[model samples]
Target: MKKSLLIIALAISIISCNKETQTTEAAAFKTAYIDTSKLMEEYTEAKDVAAKYKSKSDEAARKLEVQEANFKSDANYFQKNAQANGQAWAQQKGAELQQRQQQLQYAAQTMAQQLQEGHAVEMDTLVKSVKKFIKDYGKEKGYDYVYGTGDAASVLYAKDSYDITDEVVKLLNDKYTTSAKKEETTETKKEEKK
Candidate 1:
C-alpha cells in the first residue's frame, strides 16, 4: 500500500507538469509590427491622397501669388501717381489700397485656415482607416498583438520576421489599385453611355 501511494503521487506530479507546460505553450503570443512612416510613404492610397492635397495646396499658392502680384502692381502705380494726384487724392487712394491689402491678407488667411482644416480631416480619416485595416488583419492572421513603430515608436524591438510593414503596405497598395481600377471602369462605362 505504501508503494502504491508513492506511485500515485508521482503520477499526479507528472500530469500536473504536463498541464503546466501545455498552458504555457497555449499562452504564447503571435505578435507583429508595422512601421507607420513606411506605411505612409509606401501605401498607395496614402501617397495618392497626399499628392491630391499637394496639388490643391499648390493651386492655392498660385492664386495667392497672383493676388500678391496684382497688389504690388497697384502699389507701384499708386507711388508713381501719388504726387500728381496731390495730398487729398493721394490720401484717399492710399486708404483704398490699405483696405485692399487688408482684404487680400484676410482672404489668404482664410484659405490657409481652410486648407489646414481640410488636411487635418483627411489625416484623421486616413489614420482611422489604417487602424481598422490593421485590426482586421490581426484577426485574420491570428495575431495576438499588432504594433506600430515609427518616429513615435509603439514597438521597441521585434524580429525582422515579425516586422510585417512590407506585407501591410503591399496589401494596402493592392487594395487601392483594385479600387482605382474599379472606379476607372465605372467612369469609362458612364462616359460610353453618355
Candidate 2:
C-alpha cells in the first residue's frame, strides 16, 4: 500500500509538470518590427502623395512669381515716371503700389498656410492609415507585438529576421496598385456610359 501511494503521487506530479510546460509554450508571444523610414520610402501611396503635393506647391510658387514680376515691373515704371507724372499722381501711384505689395504679401501667406494645412491633414491621414494597416497585419499574421523603427527608434535591438519592412512594403504597394487599377477601370466604364 505504501509503494502504491508513492507511485500515484509521482504520476500526479509528472502530469502537473507537463501541464505547466504546455502553458508556458502557449504563453510565448510572437514579436516583429518594421523599418518605418524604409516603409515610407518604398510605399507607392506615400510617394504619389508627396509628388502630388510638390506639384501643387510648384504651381502655387509659379503663380506667385508671375504676380511678383508684374508688380515689380509696375513699380519700376512708376519710379521712372514719378516726377513726370506730377506729385499728386506719384503719391497716388505710390499708395496703389504699396497696396498691391501688401495684397501680394497676403496672398503668399495665405497660400503657404493653406498648403501647409492641407499637407499636414493628408500626412496625418496617411499615418493613421498606415498604423491601422500594421495593426490589422499583426492580427492577421498572429503577431502579438509589432514595433516600428525609424529615425526615432523605439526598439533598441532586434534581429534582422524579425524585420518585416520589405514584406509590408510589398503588400502595401500591391494593394495600392490593385486599387489604382480598379479606380481606372471604374472611371473608364463611367466615361463609356456617358
| Candidate 1 local lDDT, residue 166 | 94
Per-model TM values vs. the true structure: 0.86, 0.86
Instruction: Identify the runs in model 2 with alpha carbons over 4 angstroms from their true place.
Output: 1-27
lDDT of 2 at 114: 90
Minimum summed lDDT over a 10-residue window in model 2 is located at: 22-31
C-alpha displacement of 48 in model 1, angstroms? Answer: 1.1
The residue pairs in collision within model 2 are: none
Compare the candidates by lDDT and give the number of the best one.
2
Q: Which tens-of-lDDT digit does each residue in 1-194 have in candidate 2?
A: 99999999999999999999999987788999999999998899999888988999999999999999999999999999999989999999999999999999999999989989998898889889889999999999999999999986899899999999999999989988999999999999999999
Q: Residue 77 error for model 2, in Å? A: 0.3
**Can you give the lDDT of residue 137 in candidate 1?**
96
